[model samples]
Target: MICIMLVVAVVTTPGTSMASVKMEPLARTAPPPVEFKIQGSFDPSNSYLDQGTATISDNGNQTVKISVITEAKSSVASIGGTVYLQKWTGTQWINVGSASTISASNDWYFSGEVVKPAEQGYYFRARVVHWINHNGVYEQGETTSDSRLVS
Candidate 1:
């Protein structure tokens, strides 16, 4: 009877099978958003301009200027940037072909600026990048990406 009972138990509870169970680590913490604001820039890094409240000058053609600090001061070769210009329609703000930013940064990156839109009320931003050590090194200030507001 004991032997029969043991055989039945073994059949009912198949021994550990690797395929039968999966073990995943408990999530350390819930992930936050990648881009909370749609089509916007505000660098948590502080090296680039602030996204929330950037200065946009309406000098006929607009001009944007902002300060940035390097997180790690290193000998760099070049910088990369992603420029995005935001235009205000009657109701909402939309992007107007912010440059693809296939460009590299020279000394101008040390002090950054972007040309404003020819049309009034259009804002501009230049996400400056510093190319370092033959590597595309950059810091978007204190955020995921750098950003500025054009007037």
Candidate 2:
């Protein structure tokens, strides 16, 4: 004669379930609307100069064209300035090339332009030191253009 025995075991967490559970959705709100106001018009007669403009453009062939225009309130003995081509070197701006021009006689405005070869993958801008000579005294102002990249 022979004898045999059998045994079984089961385990589970105290406060957990084996089935999936759904979560509540989060709430989202939109921001408030914004408003803007306009002020008065500009008056140019109160200033010593009327306008000073500078610009820089890419020529699509590793070159750039820079230009500047300066206007004074009244005609002077002379009006002119130097146009500078500046390059961005990651830290600061440095002059690459420059050209200067003055009116042949008394004039109210002056303009100049220059074309310079630029390096590929670099930035450039135009800077002008505008000046006017009345009688014997000289008044000077400065203007800078928007930067452009050469491809």
Candidate 3:
């Protein structure tokens, strides 16, 4: 997980490819395949992006705002597959937010508030899986981001 702040990271895959990695039976020797890749903005507005930030809110229900980057490469190709937002209960993190898959043929802007936010003072994380062409699994998936603390 090379963190230059933000890179278009490649997620876990199902089958084997030159860039494939097995996350089910994770090989201790293998490393996390997520990377903060420099992106060329398709729009004539920005030049480059270094990172992304996921802002979580705890207003009434827990909500999360993901900063999205368009015109990205295969780095984010896998990340747009699945999103599972969870919050730490007393013992374990429970699914208290959004967890679903949607179309990503286009750019996925992550700048939106979710329905349920994480619990106050609880730990939260967003799990993303790279589905191959919106299929079941990717040749590679990783829990790239760490568990963010909910406030």
Candidate 4:
């Protein structure tokens, strides 16, 4: 017997594109573990970031949806930062679009979305940075999401 599956994943930003994928046959494999804590102990006086996630889905009518999520370890008041949707351009990362956020929470979470272009799909991910006053000093931290192939 033969089987096929359709999977939609990853996020995108404005002037960027995300792709959906179709697979043939299924394989039995173990899923990877999820890590929450930072590689080292998180310091309160220092800036830290968690590489968040992105996902893309087919929105029908020749359109796709791109969604990106980023997180940081600081809740300093009047916190502000930027979320960048980047695409791997053979050698380096290039920004496709970006958005900003401000929050008063300890754990910072950002989510943004955009409609994909009609043509031209590429491998895309999300990166976020916290650049604002943190405890009377300007601190910043950045992390990138996992790369996803869009078709």
Q: Candidate 4's residue-wise lDDT over 20-133, tens digit each?
A: 334322212222233363422223565644334445554434344656554566454434445566666655667775453534444466556656442234555555554545
- Model 4 clash pairs are 9-56, 10-54, 10-55, 10-56, 11-54, 11-55, 19-150, 19-151, 75-106
At residue 6, candidate 4 shows an lDDT of 91
* Model 4, C-alpha of 85: deviation from truth (Å): 1.0
Give the deviation of candidate 3 from the true structure as CA RMSD. 20.7
The per-residue C-alpha lDDT of model 1 at residue 39 equals: 31
Which regions in candidate 2 have their CA more than 4 angstroms from the true location? 1-48, 102-104
Per-residue C-alpha lDDT of model 3 across residues 1-151, encoded as one tens digit per residue = 8767666776555565745553332122222234463322123222221223333333423344432222223333333334567654545655654575533443433232234455444556554433333233233232323555443
Candidate 1 — worst ten consecutive residues by lDDT sum? 142-151
- Candidate 3 matches the true fold with a TM-score of 0.39
Residue-pair clashes per candidate, as listed?
23, 0, 19, 9
Per-residue alpha-carbon lDDT of model 2 for 30-67, expressed as tens digits?
Answer: 21122242221123442444566777898878888777
TM-score of 4: 0.44
lDDT of each: 0.37, 0.66, 0.40, 0.50
- After superposition on all C-alphas, the RMSD of every candidate to the true structure, in Å, is 20.7, 20.7, 20.7, 12.1
The pairs that clash in candidate 2 are: none
- Predicted structure with the largest TM-score when compared to the true one: 2
Question: Native-vs-model 1 lDDT?
Answer: 0.37
Best by lDDT: 2
